[model samples]
Target: MPNYIALDWEQDQLFGIEADVNSGAVRLKRAFNLKWPDDVGTDPSARGQWLGTQLQEHRISASQALVTLPREDAVVRHLELPPCPADELSELVRFQAAIKSTRPIDELLLDYLPVEIADDEVAQSVLMTTVAREQSDSIRQTLESAGLTLASIGLTPVAAAELVVRVEEQQRLDETETSLVVWAHGDRVEISVIKRRSLLFTHSTRLTSTEDTSQHIQTILAEVSRSFVALQKLLPDVSIARGWIIAPNEEAETLAARLQERLSISTVSIPEISVRTIDPLNLSGSATVPIDVPGSHAPYVGPAGILMWASGGRAEFVDFLNPRRPAEVKDTRKLRAIVIAASVAVIIGGGLFWRQSEVAALEKAYLDAKSEQSSLEELQERAAGNVENVTAVQEWVDNRVDWLAKSHDLFNDMNGTERYYLTDLRMTLAGGSGAGNITGNGESKTYGEVITLYQDLGEHPERVVNTHEIPRGKDAEYPFRFELDINLQKPEPIEEPARDDAEDTKTETEEE
Candidate 1:
């Protein structure tokens, strides 16, 4: 199962679904919703963090996710061009879209799908889609922060168009037939025209909360009529024979009856949940939302349809964020020929050069080995001779500092005559370890003066490792008598490894 996450941005809520694209079937694993934040305007990271938490809670894991931007965030247009070269048609579409759009071309992310208008292979009709760069970039950055790459940035109406095609396919409708789809979402309604499996026209409008149900119905119908008229003018060759209403069952049935009476066309209400599902009750986040809802199941329809569109079930829409890069898709036929030709060349060249290089390398290595063998004894002698020199250098480097001078510097800063007096002092250096021990006794008139002698020695910790003091009972002047023990850091001894008998014999013979 190839699974993906689909995200939908609506006016009041953010909807997401995890589904598997198993061939033609799109199975919904879980669906989740998060309330749109009030601080979404100032702090954009709030949305990403919220979505990431929701995904974690639902355990929805996918490498990439598809997204549907709100209808108002994007611009969709159906463009028709006069006969021109296939390559130039895209440029023409861009020019037309730029002229009609209020924003500059560079300020928007644009893509298009060429709709097949006729079977004669000369028609140049296209569906041009554009979204504000800021809007697309904002959503893209948010998803990126959540560790999800935006595989496709689509629109609600475009997703609805895909659902319309899938619905027709499941119903086994004619391929050349045309139909009108009216999809009602929360606080918004989208009307689209799909002809021969290609989206022809799409329009979206905000639905106000009104007490009069009839007035609300009239507003939707009027918008539908307007869209229908516009579609006729745009594609005069095609006619929409039937219409489908996608909404809650009761509301859809009522709207369909009214729409049929007003437009004099057959209209039917399609179920809000259109896809074939293995389990309907286990559809919410963590498979917890019941199949039943208070009002209707209209909200789940849009998200499910968007998932179907992303899972290779629909083919008429273009993704702006992750559009197919024609340049990146190499012609495998030409690549295969080149690879084959290169293989033959490599085999021929390798067969000729391999044996020659191998023989030459082997001969060179043999000569180099023989030369190294001849110099081995000399190298060993030189290594043995350097050991004594290395040991001398190490001994001199470690004991270079004179401990007698360092100890002299320690007492030079002390005022023995005024502050304190040393009763007895002796310094001893341990054998070879280069460590010195100093034991001394000092007498002072007061205990404070006795502490001065200890402070003076502590000032030079580099020479005096540590010091201890013991006071003798006071007598007269210089009455406070203190005993001291001080240890001094010393130079480290040099260590040399034991020589083997063979090395000793070589050294002795060299000396001889």
Candidate 2:
């Protein structure tokens, strides 16, 4: 079951029903009739608050609502046009309405019933309905203030027509002929004509309030006659085989009896509510409201009619909120913008993917370089050990004394001797630094020659020490034997003396 709230906004009163349709029948769950507060007058806020309080007490929980605008609130037009394209019908109606309306067309909200056979079922006429945008917004705001959302909006006359047609279908009436429906509630009467389930004509007439039921009946009869004459002018050969009356059973029976006695309509009776079930005990929203205050079940016609429109009778009703419009135009600029946006998104996505791949490749390269660096570090450790060994050998070679030069100098000293010979000669490190000693033993023919050689070796900065000297046999070729230890020092680095250019020139002049 689908739930919806049906609201009928009448002058000084708000009639509502919370219902659900089961199978094809509308079951009234809760109903309310809130009168405008006498203290608040016409203040919308106070009215909304009072209505909300009443609803809360009644427990009307359906949030979405269908509203019925009183017939006077909308402008209705019936036009018979030359057959045109279905799509162009809307534009044609709009242009015609604009020409007729005193106000700008943009200020009005419009809805229409499409072309349908006239009351005669031969000619066709269109019903175009419009309401002021300000009126529609006011209704919307009023409902919103009462904690209700506006789902659809429609005129009371069209809704009443829909109700009567739907009730006719339920009663298994002959649908082949045109039907006329009369709905009287509050201070107005709604008269609608139908053919083949399509609404042909509907009119709302205000009545003066009177205590006499006969007077109401007489006034209704007069209006019914006038409506028929007017309908005849629109559809010359109109055929209305049956008629329906929706009102309280007493008033309905009286009016139907009177109509049957006077009019040519074959059958005129009250449309049955078997498809719509309402409990009188459940109708009142507030506990304080008396069950008998509503008097009869007839006043719920507006809500019930709109409910029918919301359910399945949509094609018969004109909804001002959601109306038939002209052919929709497509914007080429919007299409181009969409295409451009899609292209930009694709480019950005591709760029991001490329950047991600590039970053991944660079990271892999960095890891590979790190691995290669580890291997190079191991090779460097081996090379460093080899370099230290080579450096140690180079230091040894550099620090070693010049043994060949020492031996040649010693031999030159010996050549000065009468007889000279060396038994042993060795170079040993005298200190831990780059200095060593040359040790040798030699024999000379005379002691004087040996002494002279020692004196020659004992030059300043070069040390010569005589360890032992002995006389040899007289027959020996050398008479003296000597042991000598000589200390050889590493050469000191000498800094070049700066030349005196003036002194040199002076000396050159003196030499010249």
Q: Which model scores highest in lDDT? A: 2
Report how far residue 206 has shifted in candidate 2, in Å: 1.4
Instruction: For candidate 1, give the lDDT.
Output: 0.68
How do the residues 333-422 of candidate 2 rate in per-residue lDDT, one tens digit apiece? 998999999999999999999999999999999999999999999899989999899998887777777778777876765665446667
lDDT of each: 0.68, 0.72
User: Which residue pairs of candidate 1 clash?
Assistant: none
* Residue-by-residue lDDT tens digits, candidate 1, 264-347: 542222222221211222223212342233444555555666666655655477678754333444569988989998999899
- Per-prediction CA RMSD (Å): 34.1, 14.9
Each model's backbone clash number: 0, 0
After aligning candidate 2 to the native by TM-score, how far in Å is the CA of 118 from where it should be? Answer: 6.3
In angstroms, give how far residue 200 of model 2 lies from its true place. Answer: 1.1
